[model samples]
Target: MHSMRLKDKIVVITGASSGIGAITAQMLSKRGAIPILIARSEDKLKETASGIQGRFGMYTCDVRDSARVEETFAEILHAYGRIDILLNNAGYGKFADFTEMPSEEFQDMMDVNYMGIVRCTKAVVPHMLERGSGQIVNVASMAGKIGSSRAVAYTASKHAVLGFTNALRQELRKSGVVISAVNPGPIATDFFKIADPTGTYVKNVAKMMMTPEHVSEQIIKTMEKSKEEMDLPGLAAFGIRLYGLFPRLADKLTYNVMNKK
Candidate 1:
C-alpha cells in the first residue's frame, strides 16, 4: 500500500503535555500536519501549542473520563470536520512488587494505561468509520510483550493495550481504518520520576533509554506506513520474539541479562 502523506492531516494526540506526545506534536506540525493536542493540563497544552509553527488546537481532557473524552472529540470534530489520525498515548506506570503494591495503585494503572486508550479510541473511531479512512496508533510498552521484575501492574496494563490493539485491528480489517501499536522500551522522560520514584530502574536502564524524538519519529513513520506494530530498539525486539518462541529459555536469558551489573 502507498504510504499516506503527513501534510494537512488532522492528527489527534493524547497525553500531549509532555514526553513523547509533546515531541510528536512538534514533529507533526513541522511536517505540515495539523496536530490537536489533548492532556489533563490545560496550561501545559497551551505551552505545547505555543511552540508549534502552524495552526493547532489544545483540549484538556483526562482520557480516563469517558464523558470528557467524548466531549473533547466532539469539539474537535466540530472544529476540524474530521480526524485523520488518533494517537492513544496517555498512560502512566508504577514499578513495585505486586505483593507490596496497593489495590488503589493497581486500579489507577489500569484506569490510565488501559481504559484511557479504550475511551479515546471509542470516541474517535466512529468518526473514522464514517469517513472509511483513518489511523489509530496505541503507545504500548515492551513490558506488554515480556514480563519484567517490579512492574506487575504496569506490565498487565500494557499487555491489555497490546491485546486490545490486535483485536481491534482484526475487527477493523476491512473498515479502511488502520490500527497499529508502538511498543517502546524505557524512554528518556519524566515518566521515570513517577514510575520509579527511587530512581533505581531509571539509572540501571539509562544507557538503553531512547529519546522521545527517536520514538516519535518511528511513530510518525508508522502512521504513514500503517505498520501493524513496532518494538523499539532492535535488541529488545529480538528478545521479545525469542520469548514468544521459547518462553522457558528466554526467561532464564532475560533474568541473566537484567541481573548483569
Candidate 2:
C-alpha cells in the first residue's frame, strides 16, 4: 500500500449512496480518512457506512436543494470543526436526444450536476480559506470535454461543472485551497440503468467500461495530492487531447463511430 496521506483527513462526499461516491467513501475510510457521506436517502447512507471499518459519518442531503445543502454542511462543520476535503460526487444523467428529452429532466441534471457542486463548494470555501488549507474534488465526466449524441443534457451539465471548477481553481490559486476535476469514461455503475434504459449504450461499450473501484482509486489519488484534472484510462485522456487539436475530424468520428456506443 502507498503512504496514507489521507489518514485523519475529513472528507465530505455527496451523492454517496451508491456508485463511485459510495465506493470512494469506503476507500477513504480504509485510508484512515473520516468520510462524511451525503445523499438523499438516509437508509441508503447508513447502508453505505455499514461497510466501513473505521470512523465515518452520514447525512441525508439532496444536493439539489440549496438550503438543505447549506444546512447539511453547517451541521457537518460544527461536528467535525473543519472539512479537509469535499468530493462533489452527487450527480445523475438521463440519455436522450435533445429534442426528445423532457425540460424537467434537463433542469434536474443541471440542478444536481452543476449547481449542486456550486452549493457545496460555496458552503466549504470560507471555512477552508480561514484555515488556509483544503481540497475540493468535483466528479465531472469525459463527456464534459467530448460531447456525444443522445446525452446532450448530461454533456451540457458536466461541461458546466468543468467550467465552474476551472474558474474556481484559478480564483483560489494562492489560497491554500486545491480544486480539481476528475473525468472518467463510461463506468460500470448503476448510472447506466438511468442513463441508458434501453440497454443499448451499455451493451455497445461493455468491454470499454471502467469499474467503480478503479474510478474511486483515481479520486483518492486526487485527495492525497491535488491535480488540475485527472482523466481515467490514459487512452481516453489522449483521445480528449486529440479531439481538442482537430475538432472537425473529431466531430465526424464522434458522430459516426463513438455515438453508436
Candidate 3:
C-alpha cells in the first residue's frame, strides 16, 4: 500500500484524550507518526495511549497553563530532537445565550480554546522555523465561520482560530511551515454530552451531525495534502458558502426550517 507514513516524524497533539484528539492519535499512529498525546487527564490519556500502543507517548497537562505547555513541549523536543507536526485541539465549551452567560464562562472558553492554541503554536514555531519545515493544524468549529446564538464564547474563540491560522500561514509562508484550520460541523463526541446533557443543542440538531471518525478522516486527508482549510462532511462547507453569499435568505430559511422555530 502507499505510505502516508509519518514514520520517524513526531506529532504533538493537545486535548488528546477523547474526541478528535483521541481519534487523531490512532490515525496518525496507523500512518507511522510517533504520537505525543497531551491532555490534563492522565487517566484518560493513558487509556487512549494504552489502546494505541506503538511508538506513542502521553503527557498530562492543561493546555491553558501556558508555562506548563511550553515546558512540557520543550521536554518533548529535547527528547525527540524534532517535532514535525503540531495539532492544537485542546478546547472546552460553555454555551448559553451571551447575555445570560457569566463572564467567567466566556473567559474560560477563550483561555482554553484560543490561548491553548496560542501557547502551543508559540512553543513549536521556533523549532519548525529552525528546521524550515512543519505543519500546524488548529481544530476550529463550523461555529468559527458562522455566528450562532447560545454559543457566543465558543463562536468567538473559533473565529479567532481561523484568523490566527490565516495570519500565521501568511507570516510563515516563506518559512516552509504549513498552518491550517479544520472546521468540523458537529462530530459525535462527549463534548455535547458534557455541554448539553439535556440534549439542548443535539436534541434539536443531531440529524445533521457527523461522526468523529468522519471528521478525522478528513483531517488525515487535509494533513496529507497540507491543505490550508478543511470543512468536514462536505455539506457543511457547502452550507457555509451558500449562506455566506445569501445571508438574508439563508437566515430566514434556517430559522424557519432548520431551527423549526
Candidate 4:
C-alpha cells in the first residue's frame, strides 16, 4: 500500500470538470496536492475547484486547441515553477456504426482523444525532461484494447493513445520522466450521455459499471508508484489477457456479451 506522498505536489489534470477527472482532483487535493484543473468550461472548472480544500488553480483550455494548450501550460509553469505530474483525461466518445458515423465525429475523436494527449504532452515533456523528473498519465479505455460494436472511431483513438504511450516511454527510457496508461472498463459517468445517447448501452451494462470513486482510487494508486500501466477491476484485466491469448474465442464473446452494449 506504499503510495507517492503527494503533499504539496502540483498536478495538472485535463477534463477536471467532471467524472473521474473531477473526483481524482478532489482526492489529490485532499492529500495536499495542488490540482491545476483544466476543462473547456470555465464555470465547471470553478465548480471543481470549489470542492477542493487545498490550494488549486483552474484554466479553461480545450484539448482540441493546440495553441491554447501550450499557452495554458506556460501560464501554469510560470505560476507554479514546476509541475510534478500530468493527467491527460480530457476526451469524449460518440457511439455509431462506422458508415453511419459523421466524418466530423471521427476527426473530433482523433483530435481530442489522441492528438489532445500529443499536444499536452508536447507542451509538458520538455519541461519535465529538463527537470529530470515527472510523470504523465493518459486515461485510455478498455475499448482501446478490445474494440466493441458502435464506437469504431473512439476505439481507434484510444488505440493510438496506447501506441503513443508505449513508444514514448521507450523514447524517454533513461530520462527519468515516466509515462503511463490507464485502461479501465465502463464506469458510471455522464460519458454515456454522449457515447450512448439512447441509454441503451448503459442499460445493457448497468450491473457491470464501476463507480468514479473506484476508478479514481486506482488512478491515485497508479500515480503513487508511477506504475507503468494499469487495467482496473481485475476481472476486466483478466479478460483482456484472455483476449490476447485466444483472439477467436474472445471475439465471439465480445460480440455476444459486450457488443450488446
Across 148-168, the per-residue lDDT of candidate 3 in tens digits comes to 667788889899888988999
lDDT by residue (21-116, candidate 2, tens digit) is 999999998899999999999988888988999999899998888899899999999999999999999999998888999999999899999999
Order the numbered candidates by lDDT, best leading: 4, 2, 1, 3
Pairs in steric clash, model 1: none
What is the lDDT for 150 in model 2?
89
Estimate every model's Cα lDDT from 0 to 1.
0.90, 0.92, 0.84, 0.92
Q: List the residue pairs that clash in candidate 4.
A: none
lDDT of 1 by residue, 1-261 (tens): 323498899999999999999999999988889999999999999888888999898999998888999999999999999999999999998877889889999899999999999999999899899999999999999889887777889989999999999999999999999999999988999898888888887778778889999999999999988888999986777888788899999888788555322
Off by over 4 Å in 2: none
* Alpha-carbon shift of residue 257 in model 3 (angstroms): 6.3
For each of the candidates, the C-alpha root-mean-square deviation to the true structure, in angstroms, is 2.2, 1.0, 1.7, 1.3
Ranking by TM-score: 2, 4, 1, 3
lDDT of 2: 0.92
lDDT of 1 at 171: 100
Compared to the true structure, candidate 2 yields what TM-score?
0.98
Higher-ranked by lDDT: 1 or 4: 4
